[model samples]
Target: MKRDMRKTEREISKEEAKDILLKGEYGVLATISDEGYPYALPLSYVFADDIIYIHGAKEGHKLDNINFSSKVSFCVVGDTKVLSEKFSTNYESAIVFGKAMIIEGEEKTHALKHLIEKYSPDFMVSGLKYIENDQHRTTAFKIEIEKISGKARR
Candidate 1:
């Protein structure tokens, strides 16, 4: 299969791409509904074991879209700064193509814990209690990455 096509010269290595994903605070997840409409939502996520984990309400448009179609795209932009004098911006970004599905049991709990670590490291005790209390109130999903590419303008 062919590799990334856009800005091939500026494409970064897999390691760089993964690094960006790990450090990114949020990402945009794109999905296609059953009616053929596309939807994109910005969400907080955790990158682990080469998979992307996201949590949300047990039911919603995102879940509906995922149920209708497994294919999805997620994008994360990092370290962006506008350079007015140069009329351009310096940035790093990564786009991931993958299949997503709701996870349950141990895997779901593990992903949730990872999220706590990433987002609330200082409140681990409270976070654990919160997870225990709300575990049934939320749903955790994992995206098994198929293809990912990173680019930079620095």
Candidate 2:
């Protein structure tokens, strides 16, 4: 992606980066371990269609670094206000390069109910008592989008 004139040439349209990851909430998941080292976590995601849903705990360290490298890189950003210094840089960002798996039965309980109705839609009315007990204490995944790019700085 080397064509930088400070980079923006109108390239931010995978449904506008999935509507900024479905109205932007949180993102920053880059993983690589098994001694290769490089793990960044700050997740709370759920973007469908092109795939991107996350959840952890059934074990730690980002699921032992995606079970020793599933090669992932997910990102989402929207909410940066600094429109000055040449009148640009308000911000909207998305980056995804994926190959993460581990989603299990019933598509990991339907992607955790679409990540709880996209980050908690009023607790989804307790969704049948947390789908009959929090689907066995969290563990969901799906990155699949082998390529994605986005940008907006104004």
Candidate 3:
């Protein structure tokens, strides 16, 4: 479903949106709990091959939510600042709606390694060691983005 942006000037191009997602430091993964409650958490992630990958413990609230429902949404804010004089904030952000699923084996390992490379590229030697030690205890999931939109106020 597509919604018209009230502020046409603020709508960002798809390429721009993809760039933001690729370079973003982190994003919030929103999920629905088994109890039908909304749960959102900030997470470190890596965007690769048109997929968003995140790593976490083998089990937790987020995992539980993903198990209960594959539908999820992710949001990343690029930059923001409060414009006190105008009483409006200037910001750029992207939101993605997608299906989330737990992945294992090589896919999981690749995602974990991608994250290590993104966040700890300077320490890859130890990063690989860390991944080797914690791989089994970690759960990696991928979000296949179905719809995405971006907006910005310059």
Most accurate candidate by TM-score: 1
Local accuracy of candidate 2 as per-residue lDDT tens digits, 1-154: 2343366685677778778877878899999888888999888978876688788889998888998988888888976787677676678888888888888888887788888898778888796479568778878889898777788765
lDDT against the true structure, each candidate: 0.94, 0.81, 0.92
Best by lDDT: 1
- Candidates in order, TM-scores: namely 0.96, 0.35, 0.94
10-29, model 3: which lDDT tens digit per residue? Answer: 99997788888999999999
Model 1 regions more than 4 Å off: 1-3
Which prediction has more favorable lDDT, 1 or 2? 1
RMSD of 1: 1.3
Task: Kindly report which residue pairs in candidate 1 clash with one another.
Answer: none
- Using TM-score as the measure, name the better of candidate 2 and candidate 3: 3
Q: Which candidate, 2 or 3, would have the higher lDDT against the true structure?
A: 3
For candidate 2, give the lDDT of residue 108. Answer: 84
Candidate 1 lDDT by residue in tens digits, 1-154? 1364667888998899999999999999999999999999999999999999999998999999999999999999999999999999999999999999999999998999999999999999999899888899998999999999899988
Poorest 10 consecutive residues by lDDT, candidate 2: 1-10
